[model samples]
Target chain A: MAKSTIKLRTKEKGGKIQVKALITHPMETGLRKDKKTGKKIPEHYITKVVVEANGKPVLTADWSGSISKNPFLSFSYAGSKDDTVKLTWTDNTGKSDSIEKKVGEK
Target chain B: MKRRSFLKGSIAAGAAGAGLAAGILTPNMAFADDVADNPFKAKSVDEVLKMLGASGAESSDKIKIKAPEIAENGAVVPVGITSEIPGTTEIISITAKNPTPLAARYTFGEGAVPAIKSRFKMGKTTDVIAVVKAGDKYYTAKKEVKVTKGGCGG
Candidate 1:
């Protein structure tokens, strides 16, 4: 599967750079009815997420069915000289995706 | 369909008479009692996400998000985010693409740690998003969560 997209932005002097990422997937909460068959939908959800800067992991997340589709994530990292960050995620279906971003220090 | 009609019909019944109002009110009150703490409302993840303005493009890595490998209960899965980055402005939003994407939204000021933890209901299996804002930038982290039968009332 394709990895999620990570966006890094420049932070102010002594400011933290903001990083945002999004992955495309159906966060299927097996609760609603199928539009066609009118049957309850099967369950599908993501379970874990991790983030690293210049290869050093910094943030992680745990999730459930309550989350929305095509999960979106936002967080911050100490403005670093490394200029690169990595991200990874795994789902309940034994699926995983990861990506990396370059930070702009302007 | 039935549930929607039931909700509307009860509202109509409540408007009919004081007696009917009392009668209809009892069930709603009972429902509130039944789900006094069932934070789950039947909305798709997309709708919830939009409602909260939690688009990840405006998020940043200054915040840290933590979640579990597997959730035993869909109704009460725990999620956490902490900002170790400087100039942290605000931390907000949780989305699960199951039944209503936007779970919750939080706001903070500069220098605020912007760390938060909360329980959310998952309609099924899906990925979750933690969107945070630092300074003038936005960041996000995502995790996939698996829900077993024991979690939701399955």
Candidate 2:
């Protein structure tokens, strides 16, 4: 399983805090025909992604062959006390990976 | 000069001017035009959902996606996504109709962006739909970007 990790940090806000994350993957579409091989690359892409915070699920996405390689995502969340956000991804090839991060109040 | 011959000459000139105008407008129109007409041979979002077999979903307005209004090059158009929604979970996609609509899919581990940035090559102009799964439902937004003639070749 190819795993990933996210590290979240936020400035102290009286109400809510924002969080961000990044993932590592090839995200190959397998569409372009290789010049030398002269064959269409087999479809090997991330089909699903999941993100969780403090034991609660927050965001998820479905992907297609159009995504670029090594995708980078950023987002914000209402922060509370010590919270943890977890991430996981699965590809069409059935390969999956996961990682975790701790949220800190600034 | 013969009256009939003079009238005919003016008509020919008028036609040429109209033709040139059309030629110039064509390029501009192509830039703003969405590729829905030639949508990439892609699958429907519903079909992808069934294939992925996802369970949890969420919809939130906190998500925002930014890309160029008109991409000169369809080969590599940059896209960025940001979510203000709390407790981010998943991100999914589906182009109206492409060979394979599921674009780049990602999830957050710890310090992941409620957002993601990537470059996608558009065979033609089309709407890039970004669906963010938060909580237990799906929330989505889409923007149509025009893929004009690129440097590679039109």
Candidate 3:
């Protein structure tokens, strides 16, 4: 199995679930030129990210290359412990990755 | 052999038609089409807002943007947005001076909070605008973040 590109953490506090995720990606803007090659890099970035709680989507985000490399995202949702939380991201090149975890577990 | 090939072709066509219908019916598929069409490629914040059907958004104090006044490294600038408006369905972040101003757009569903924290790149000093959409109306807050170094180039 390939190593997961996403690092996710969720905590249930005060009846709310705080979710923080860090995704490893280059997020190339296509405008940058390689210092050695002198050639523009092709545009590559994550286009969409979806976060679901208990199999239902709680948040969705559309992103561009302007987002920093290895993007970090944090948000909170009203949910209880033991609920299933899943985070998935799709990039422009049709590459995608996802990770699932139970709330309050790690 | 000819009849067998003809029947296979017809089956493939039927399958494609069904897939097209399913794509149209799925909300996620429609959203994918929308993303492919506009906003991310827009060069200006105004153009992005227009594509999002949020032109002439009003300035609001209820929206708060937390970011450093000056960033030593433009490659990674931490930013956060909090919307106090009720029924806020969406939040968008824009870096005014970036080549592509529209940075990110987040949609919240039921049981979700209206606050978000993320990181973005800045080519130079720019105004970071946070737009909040609530019940058909758009509200915005702006904060200036000065970048000591640009982030776009290698």
Clashes of each: 77, 55, 0
Query: Considering summed lDDT, which 10 consecutive residues are worst modelled in model 1 chain B?
Result: B33-42
For candidate 3, the iRMS in Å is: 0.6
Full candidate order by TM-score, most accurate first: 3, 2, 1
lDDT of 2 by residue, B1-154 (tens): 5997888799879986886666666776564232222222236655555544542334445777788989887666788777667765666555544556666555655544466655665666777777776676667777788778431122
The fraction of reference interface contacts (C-alpha pairs within 8 A across chains A and B) present in each candidate is 0.12, 0.45, 0.90
In model 2, the runs with Cα more than 4 Å from the true position are A1-17, A104-106, B1-65, B72-93, B102-121, B129-142, B148-154
* Candidate 1 structure quality by residue, lDDT tens digits, A16-80: 65666566667667665577886677777776676667666555555656555666666565655
Best by DockQ: 3
Tens-digit per-residue lDDT, B110-140, candidate 3: 9999999999999999999999999989999
TM-score of model 2 vs. true structure: 0.54
**Highest lDDT among the candidates is held by which one?**
3
Model 2 gets an lDDT of 0.60
Query: Each candidate's interface RMSD, rounded to one decimal?
Result: 8.8, 5.5, 0.6
C-alpha local distance difference test of each model: 0.59, 0.60, 0.93
Better-scoring candidate (TM-score), 1 or 3: 3
